[model samples]
Target: MPRIVDRDLEALRETALRMGSLAEAIVAKSLRALATADPLLCKEVQEDDLEIDRLDVAIDAAVLELLATKAPVATDLRFVLATKSVATDLERVGDLARNIAKSAARLAAAPRIELPGKLDQLAGECTRLLRRALDCYADGDPERARRVLDQDDLIDASESRVIRDAIAEIAAHPELSSQEIDLILIAKNLERVADHATNIAEDVILIAEARNLKHREKLERAGDRRT
Candidate 1:
């Protein structure tokens, strides 16, 4: 049964990684399509979302099977739950990319709006955070996961700046108000995508150590006070 268990575990890992990679590619390619307004790339993202949905279905089945057969406990149990949770966030992120792609499709014929400076930087930050989060998951490294969660605020701030600028642009140019609004929504969707990636990182940290790293600083402070 040891060999069987090992094979099951490997299968679980492979499925999760495949799903995560698809989600990551969606974010990366969607951002590029957004930045460049390349119709071909946007169409690629549209097709990629279908692949993500397919993987989600496949991974979900693998997870349920593992639980039924492996009956993992303690850290392994936590890993199973965390895998489910991360897959959920990744699925949502995939949807967000698809939404952006759909929106881009609508604007394909409309004039290309250059992604604002803050939005561009936010996309760059998200790409890095997502890459690191996936690395942490594969290696079971809590420290790298925590770092991704810590850097989330920077992306959030950039998101806020874009919102403000978008509002200003719409107010200043009433004629392009509709166009400005669509771009604004796209930027917000990307910001939320980053947030979901951070959630995955946090989930990884919690699973790898069988401890909640959430509010970690507060927990440390409380320990100090008790001591």
Candidate 2:
């Protein structure tokens, strides 16, 4: 029975990894659509999101079944719980990617405005962060997950720069406000992708170290008060 349970857990991990890969691909393709203003690419991203939604539901059901039948404990329990959390984050990443794709589709019909370089940089960083987070989850490496956490600030900073530049462009050319607003929405969606990646990394750390990094800052402040 123990051997069978272990095998089932491994299967769940593989399924979660596959879902993560699909989510990453969707985000990358959405960014490409945004860059080229390709309505076809945006359509592809929207179609891919349906698969992500299916996978999310499948993972949740698997987790529940595993818990009901096997009653996993200790490390196995952590892995099962983390898989659910990671799946949820990946689902949200897919939704954000779809939102970006929608914005890209709008931009496709509008007059092309010169997008800020910072937006490109932010897109690249968010993609890299998400990939790294998935890698850490696959490897069960808390250290690599921590590195993903460290790079999230870079995404936030780049997003801020993109927003500031887009706002300035809108102010200077009010006639272009619609297109500029679409660009701003794309940047916001990309930033949210980075946030979901951060959440996945935090879950990876929980699975590996049994330490919840999600509330580390708040917990640390509380501890300081006690001291």
Best of the candidates, lDDT = 2
Q: What's the residue-level lDDT of 153 in candidate 1?
A: 78
| Alpha carbon lDDT of each predicted model | 0.79, 0.89
Worst 10 residues of 2 by lDDT: 1-10
Q: Candidate 2 residues 134-222, lDDT tens each?
A: 99999989998989999877888899899998888889999999988988898899999988888988998888778887866677878
Clashing pairs in 2: none
Name model 1 segments beyond 4 Å from true: 1-4, 213-227
Which runs in model 2 stand beyond 4 Å of their true positions? 1-4, 218-227
- Taking the tens digit of each residue's C-alpha lDDT, what string does model 1 give over 1-227? 22135566667767778888999888888777766678898889988888888877887887887777667887777887788877887888898988887667666667766667787787788777778888888888998888888887788888888889989998898776777777778878878887787878888877877766555667787884321
For each candidate in turn, the TM-score is 0.87, 0.94
> What is the model-wide C-alpha lDDT for candidate 2?
0.89
